[model samples]
Target: MADLAQSAERFRVIARGKLADPRIQSAIDSSTDRLRSHRVDAWDELGEVEERRSRAYEIRMRAIRDIDGNLERFRTALEARGGHVAVCATAEEANAYVVDVCKRHGAKLVAKSKSMATEEIGLNEALEAAGVTSVETDLGEYVLQLENEHPVHIVAPAIEKTKEDVARIFSKEEGVEVPPVLEEVTASARRQLRQVFFDADVGVTGANFVVAETGTVVTVTNEGNGRLVASLPKVHVVITGIERVVERLDDLPHLLSLLGRSATGQRLTSYTHLVTGPRREGEEDGPEEIHVVFLENGRRNLLDTKYEEMLACIRCGSCLNVCPVYRKTAGEAYGPVYSGPMGAVLTPLLVGIDQAPSLPHASSLCGACTEACPVKIPLHELLLELRRDLVDEHETSWFERLGFSLWSFAWSTTFGYRLSSALARFGHRWASRFGPGRVWASDRELPAFAKKRFRDSR
Candidate 1:
């Protein structure tokens, strides 16, 4: 996997190339538009959408305020039900714990649900290095795995892929000719993964919410793969961020209402699994050994920071659908596990701003992401905050600092402002002879200066 700097640079190069591709732009526009429409319709159906969002936000705030206490309570309750909990401070520690679990169980094959935490820590890569096969059971995830690609969207991993792209991947994987028909493609994947589910020695999943009150791990998936990955294997391991813990069982309904509506526009997902613990004596189909890994992975550092509201995200992808930047470039452009507006804020915090210096500037700050957020995270404000922090840290180049300094000086006085406007008009006239004002705007002309300033006209 690419490190932060490499990833950000790669995104810049790839995004520029993708911008020239009509097919990519078309696919992104169509997919996000459909998701956006569905989200609006779903919220309308729920009624009192704003009220529910406020309630959910309050619950998230309360839960995060005392996150440490809730985690401890969750551990106590889970252990009482014969479940093991491991609190890992870093990705290496989390991966080590998972590797140890596989080793202890003599696991050769592991089936996995679609979990961004797993992707974040490179779990599959680690498992392969340990001589185990990790299979992605979710259909979208399966397609991505076959293509050797990362997820493009949080909920819809392969949203950027076309049906023909999927057909090619499935055909190559199955060593047979596959049609591009949606139903046919799904059936083929289901047929192939069904046996893997039964044969895998261990199952790995991520929880949507860990109810502290019941010590239950709640997983919501449209596909039944999450259930299979959690239940069919003898050992079931959950890897998730510690921020997923909620204070009460009652809080789940409120969050779920927003999650389902915002994610795929369903009132509720097709499958919602609440696993309290490992199988008891009389229990039949659940895993025999249950282990929950709460990964800190830099999250604890953000608890009291200005960006704590980021923890309120449910990985709905609603922000991505509505974000102007994301719609045009898609998730790959962000070059992180989390993408879009949330990624702009969280990636820098988790990975450090120096590595993703350009991410804060990736937004138009149109506030679409903030408006679409189910928990009402002020994403645009967070982006601005990140930009401010970057400047404070001196992460910006001297050239940018000089330009901003001059611009600030110009705008500070009336004479300077008027003079700057006249200079700007002259600069625009000469811009064509010199070169494009911005590299990305080479094809477009700078707007003509107004005939007269509004203030001067008045």
Candidate 2:
């Protein structure tokens, strides 16, 4: 919510907290390793994945290129199927749309799946502010709700917290002592959420991929919370970014195949729900009203540009697991809903570089994120582009301008570059003697420069 550059000091502090905590280290390492293995297993199951991944990437790119056309088609399809569609240009607009719908229907309580888009728009908070009680039905989200914290991982929001931590949180919630057994703790949350589901007046969710042909919104989750969140409530509201739409119904199976494989290392998540619209005539049990909110929220600017490819992201969060920075700081450091490399690029663009410019610079430019991306988003390259935008286009601080000026000067000329290289080489001895790199030193090791330059050695 705050400018990340201005908040850089705060982020450094958050990073320090994360770095100092041994529990965070262990939790991140253990969970990421397991996710890594799952991804490998999933990929192995989908052998010939390179070809499949490539095809998936092409489909998304084409869909993005003609996004306006596809979006119109999607809206038409949904309207034809009796779904109410609203286009929101900002998070505020989307939140307002949802709130108005809830108020009009006199919703007292709402149950939600893990909708990062809603989190991005602060939907639950908005509803709470409006005196409408909203419950997070996802197990991970339920834990976060009790703790009053944001999601740490896109896929597993509470990944940073262990069973012991969850048990303690639940103990506080139930007003009783609880043990650290995961199954017992999880079951307790499920029982409570099931009750909430039965009484919910509304259901809110995010679409994984929206099919333009059928005007269908699809959500994949392991816990089956999405099904309850979308099916039980009298009114169902789905929020999603404009980029999620694909060209046709057939393209969905291909993109979804890539999605399941990339996330959770599963051939398929336990539950995948696809809804075309509200329940039609003769429908047994379904929401009486269905609303689809298509949010632009700063995505249109990337169109016809190099960064447009980022729209292909399915939010599998594979990039977060492999991200060196995200591994330590976790998702909160991004100061936004989306985290990791995808967050690094998307946050600055959506929230504005002026609001959170440092996000783009947060990456170590490690290609692991790019490699892990199922849709082939060039995350590393996007970081460089953001850096360029920050320096040249955005209103940057004096220190950054001076630093880049000197950096550019040294890079352009042979003499300046060579001289700086020599000085850097000579400064190696003083590196440790100099002020502690405290921030950089925590996450990585810096090499000491040698005294002799390569050109001067001969």
Candidate 3:
């Protein structure tokens, strides 16, 4: 993927195509609206949403501030319970570790639940290259996997796919006719995945929160796939970012209370699996071996920086629900793994500003994401900071720099300001007819310059 700052024409073409598709537009709008409305109602029911958000923010910040110590403590605790821990500092190391694990166990088939961490590292592609068949058990993820696509929303992976689309995908996969009915499509998926659960040599999942105090790996899910994937296979591996750790188990209630409501409007999800370790000696059923891979992947670089607050994010997807840019273009416009307001800030941070120079400019700076965040991350403010960083580093194009410099020079003096204003007023009629103005006016009406100044009248 070429940097959009350098490939503006190509990026605009892709964005325009997505915007022109009515089905894509309708799907994104409906899904985000519903989730946004649900979150508001859920917060209203809580009656203490602000208080809970503040507490959650504090808990997350504390852990991030001392992330090295927290991760060390977590490692010791998990190791005490006979669980193994691997701290990977890059995507390559993480992928290599997971592949080595599969090779060591002689595993051929792996069952996976919804995990954005795995998506970030391209775990599925790595597994396939290593000759492992990784099956997605989550319905939305399964649909996306079959469609050869990645998730669009953090919570709703296949939010753009309708029942009819799903039926077509399922029919192709099953080698049979399937109706577009919800129940039938669901049954068809269940039938195909049931054997996968029994036959998979390993199961992989992502953690919602990791308790440093107890070394518990917590996963929240609406579907029951998370529990099955963890318990059914002989080996269970957890892949997650190091920022997910909280200093204490006591912090769970505050964070958990807001996660479901903010993400999906449920007071709590159907399953909140807290796995301490592998199955005990007398356990009837559970994975015999448990492994936790904590991925840094540029997360450590944010510590002690101005953008450190971003680590407090809990993947609630509340910000994405309210982001105007995301609702219009979806996740593909941002990147493959993360999208929306949080993605706009985190992507550039994780991947370096030079590589993704255009992401910081993806937002409208409306501050809705900050207001909707469960942990109170100032998302819009961080985006503005990123833009400043880009300017300081000279990553922006020469055209942009010249335009801004000219504007600043003009506005800094009364004579230049008056002259520019006069030019703008006189040129207003032709502004929408060509160049950048033409493109801006393609979808939106160009604002008209006022004929008279209020200061003169005063």
The lDDT, on a scale of 0 to 1, for candidate 2 is 0.84
Say which prediction, candidate 1 or candidate 2, comes out ahead on TM-score. Answer: 1
Report per-prediction Cα RMSD to one decimal: 1.5, 2.4, 1.9
Model 3 residue 127 distance off true place after TM-score fit, in angstroms:
0.8
Candidate 1's residue-wise lDDT over 57-151, tens digit each?
89988999999999999999999999999999988899989999999999999999999999888899989999999999999889888878888
| Ranked by TM-score, top first | 1, 3, 2
TM-score of 3: 0.96
Error of 3 at 150 (Å): 0.8
Give the alpha carbon lDDT tens digit for every residue of 323-359 in model 2.
Answer: 8888888777787477889988888877667777678
Of the candidates numbered 1 and 3, which has the greater lDDT value? Answer: 3
Q: Candidate order by lDDT, highest to lowest?
A: 3, 1, 2
State each model's CA lDDT, in order: 0.88, 0.84, 0.90
List where candidate 2 sits over 4 angstroms from the true fold: 1-6, 394-419, 431-446, 456-458
